[model samples]
Target: MTSKIKNNTEKPTSGIRAIAEELGISIATVDRALHDRGRISEKTRARVLQVAEQLNYHPNRAARDLRLNRRFRVSINFPTGIPPFFDALRSGIEEGALPFSSTLDIEFHSYSLPYDHARNSIQSALDASVDGIIAVPPNTFQMAELVRKANMKGIPIVCISTDVPESGRLTAITAYPFNCGAMAAEALFSHMNKRGSVGVLTGNLEYLNHAEKVRGFRTMLSQLSPAFSVAAVIEAHDDPHEAYQGVRRLLQSTPKMAGLYISTANSISALTALREAGRLDSVAVVTTDLIPELVPYLREGIVKATIYQCPETQGSLAIRTLYWYLSEGMRPLHFIGVIPQLIIRSNLDLYISTNKYIAR
Candidate 1:
C-alpha cells in the first residue's frame, strides 16, 4: 500500500535518517540514493532501494515542490458511452490531483462520431498548451496517428481505462481485461451449478481490452468447464437498446444459452430483453459494472454479479503518476495494473452506497 501518508507525523523523515546512519553514509548520499541522482555504487543503491520498499517510503511531492511553485496543465480524452465507469475514473483523477490544486490545471475532453473527432480533441489539447495528455483512444488507427503526433511534439501522454499501445505513448494504467473475462466465467458458471452454453456480450472488439476479454473468457471457460461453451458473441456498444436487440438475436440463434456475461457496462437493454423473453429467471446474467440500472437487477438477483476494475484507482493513479514523472523527474512503471473485484447481489448495496453516481 504505497498510498499517500496524509498526516505530517507519519512522514518518512525518521526512516530516511535511519537508512543513512545504518549505511554509515552522509545525508547527501542517502538523498541521492533515494532520488537516484549522482554517481552511487550499485550495491549501495540496491541496499537503499530494498530499505525504502521495506519502509514504504513515499516522498511527499506537494511538500517538496511547494516552494518551487511548479504548475502543470494536463488534458484528458475519454469515450462518450459508459458514464458510470468513465465518470468515476474522472472523479478519481480529480481526487488524486487534489494535493497539487495550486500547481496543476486539468482539462477534460470526450470523443464521439466522425473520423476527425479525436484529431480535433488533440488539437484542442495542443492549443491549450497542456503539459501532458491522458486518453482512452477509440481503438482506431487514425486515433493512433493523432496520439503519435502529440508524442512527437513532446507532450507526455498517459493512456487510461483503455489502451492504444500502437501510439507509442508513455504507459497505460488499466486492469488485465483478459483476466476479467476469465474471472467473469468463473463467477458466472460456478454459480450456475449446471454446465451449459453461455452468451458473451460486449462493446466494439476493436479495443484490445475488449478483444482480450473475449479471448480470456473463451480460453478459461473451455479449460474450467468443458461442458460450458460460448454460444454467441455480440457487440452491443454499451447501448441498452442495442444490448436488448443483441440478446434477442442471441436467443433466436443460440437456444442453449443458460448464462450471459456482459464484458462491458452497457447492459440495461439486455436485462429488458431477457425479461420480455421470459428467460430472466432461468438464465444467469453477469455484468461488468455498478451502473445505476444494474442496481435493481442485482437487488432482485436478475443480474447475478458484476466485475469492477476500480475505475477510481485507475483514474487517480494515471494522473498522479504522470504528474510525478513530469514534475519530479520520477520514472514510472510501464504497466500499472489495477486489480478487479467481483460484486454479487448480497453486497451490491454496499458497493452502490460507496460509489453513488448520478445516472444519465
Candidate 2:
C-alpha cells in the first residue's frame, strides 16, 4: 500500500483551531494545552506537542513579525578616549553582530565623558527605544540609575568589563577581576619573597573591577606574606600620562619599592616610568589586560606578568545574552563569571599574534 507524504511547509494559521481539528479535541482544550494554561493535563500537552512537531507547526510568524517590527536594536556604549583596547572591543562587537544581522540591529556609541555624561547618553539610548544596552562600567551611581531606568522601561542591560553594584542589570560579562588580582599579587609576592614594599596603581575607585582587584591583591599579599606591604594605592583615572606621573610619585615617595601592581588599563605608562627610573629590572611588575602597548614591556622582561581578559568575549556575550532574553524569553546563567588567564613571557605567544593581541 502506498502512503501519501505530508507536506511540512504548511504555514501556521489557526493555532488552537488547526491543532483541535487534527487531534479531534475541543478548541478550548487545545488552546489550554498549547499555552500551558490552567487545568491542562500533562498527557494532553504531550500529545499536542507530538502532533505539532510531526506537522512542523510553529507559532504565527506574522505575529512575531508584528511584535518585533520596531526593529531589534541594541546600543553599546563605551568610554571613549580611543584606546587600542577599546578598539579591539569594538571590533569584537562588530564581529558578534555579524551573525545576528538578519535578526537584530546594533548601534555603537563612544563617548569621552565623566559619569554624568555616560548617564545622559544611556538615557538618550533608552529614549531612542533601544531594546538592549551594553556598557563598560560607568560611575557607580550613574550606572545604578541607568540600570534602574532600563529595567523600569523593560529594556535589557548588559554590563561589560566592570560591574555596577545594585544596578539590576540583566547580565554581566567580564573577566574575574578578583581572581586575576589575586594571581598578580601572588606573582609579585613570589618574586619579591615578601620582603619589599609594592606600589598599586588603579583607575577610578568607583569601578567595581578596579576596587575588587585592589582588594584581592591586598588580601592575597597579606595572606601570603605579612611582611610585604602595599606602599600606596594611587589613582591614575585610567590616563596614561596620569599613570606615568603616579608611578613617578610613588617611586619618589617609596625608594624601597620592590614591586608594582597596575590594576587597570594603563600598564603601558607604568612600564615606561619604571624603565625611565632604571627600576624595570629591579622591580617586579604585574598588571592587568593584554594590550599591544604592553607587548614591548612584556617582551623586554620589564613587566614580569600580566593578566589577560577576553574583551571580545565580553562584547559578544553581552549581545548574545540580550538576544536570548528578547527573542527566546530566556534568562542567562545567574552570576556568569569568565575566567581570567595569567600571561607570562613564556606563554604570551598563545594569546598574541604578530605582537598584536586580537581580542577574542
Candidate 3:
C-alpha cells in the first residue's frame, strides 16, 4: 500500500488518517488502533500509536471521554440576591453550557453575605475540586487568596461582570467600567448643555467595576466640562431602599442638582424616587441597566439615558474562555474589554430583551 505520509512537518489534522499514511495501513485498521478498538493486532496498534505521537496527533478529549464519563464538572460562584442583571448573566451561562452538556458537568454556587462571607464561599469552591470555575468579582482579601489557590490547583477561572485585581485569574470578561462612567457623564452633560450641577448615586466603591466607573465619571467630567460640577456622591450599597433614600437626601441637600448620574445596578430605586418626587421632567437622569422595572420609566421620559453593559455576553464569554484555557492550554488575553452601549429611549427597542443594563 502507498504510504499516506507526505513532506509535511506540521501537526496532522486527523489522527487516524495520519497514522494510516505513516504506517501504510488501511484506514479501518488505523481507526481501530488509534481508538484501542478490538481486533487490531498488538504490533499494528503499537506502530499506529508511535506514528500518532510523532505526528503530534490530538483528539477532542472531552468528546472522546464523554462516551464513558457522565460529566465534566464546572463550578460557578457569584454573590446572591443580586438583581435581574445577574439573573441574566446566569441565564447566559446556562445557555452557553448546554452544547457542552455531554461532557460538561456544571455546579452553581451563590453567596449572600457580608464581604468576608463572600470570600469564604469562593474558598469553599476552590476546595471542592472542580474542573474549572466562573465567579463574580469578590470583595475581600480572602477571595483573592482563594483565586490564587485555585490557580495553584491548576483549575482555570473566569471572572464575570467585575474583576479582582492582582488575582492572576484565567480571564476577565467585562467592560471598562471607568470609561463607561466617563461616557455616561459625557452623555448627561451633553443633554444638559454642561450647565447644571450633577449628583452621583452609586453602589459600593470597593468593587472594581463600581470604583472604575466612579473614577472614570469624575475624571471625564473634570476634563471635559469644568463648568458642570458634581455636587455630591451618595453610596447606596446596591440596596433599592438605600438608593431611593440616598437620592432623596441628595436632591434635598443639593437643591441645584440639575442632573443625576446613577452608576450602579440600583438605578431602579433611583428612578422610582425621581418619579415619586415628580422631578423626572425637571432634572435630567442618566443611569445604567435595562431592568424590567426601569423600562416603563424610559418609555415615559422619566429617565433620559443609560449605559448598557451586556451581562449575558460577559457570562458566555467567560465560560468559553475558561473552556479554551482548560482544553487547549491557551493563555487568556490580558485585558478583554466588552464595549459599552449608549442607550436612549429612541434606540431602546433593540436592547430591551437583552440582559444589558439600561440607564433609564
Best by TM-score: 1
Displacement of the residue 45 alpha carbon in candidate 2, Å: 13
Instruction: Report how far off residue 151 is in candidate 3 (Å).
Output: 1.6
Per-residue lDDT tens digits for candidate 2, residues 153-174, read 9998888888775878887777
lDDT of 1 by residue, 1-360 (tens): 012323233466787888887778887777787777899998998888787777777656665665687767788877677787888988898888876665677777887743246667777887777889887766678878877888888787888867778887788887888889999988888767568889999887877778888998898888887888888899876566788899999998977678999999888888888888999988899889788878888888888889998999999999989888877667677777898898998877677778858233
**If both were scored by lDDT, which would come out higher, candidate 1 or candidate 2?**
1
Winner on lDDT (1 vs 3): 1
Local error of candidate 3 at residue 127 (angstroms): 2.2
What ranges in model 3 sit over 4 Å off?
A: 1-62, 65-71, 353-360
Please report the TM-score between candidate 1 and the true structure.
0.87
What lDDT score is found at residue 96 in candidate 3? 65
Error of 1 at 203 (Å): 1.0
Error of 3 at 295 (Å): 1.1
Worst 10 residues of 3 by lDDT: 1-10
Candidate 3, 1-360: lDDT as tens digits:
111112123333366776787788788887776656669888987788788778777444456545566445778877764567777787677666554555666677777645556666667777777788888765457667878888888887778878876887887878789888998888887767647688888877667888788888889988887888888888777778888999888888877778898987678778777778877877888888678777787787777788878778787777667765665465779768889888888988888654344433
Task: Pick out the ten consecutive residues of candidate 1 with the lowest summed lDDT.
Answer: 1-10
Q: What is the lDDT of residue 33 in candidate 2?
A: 65
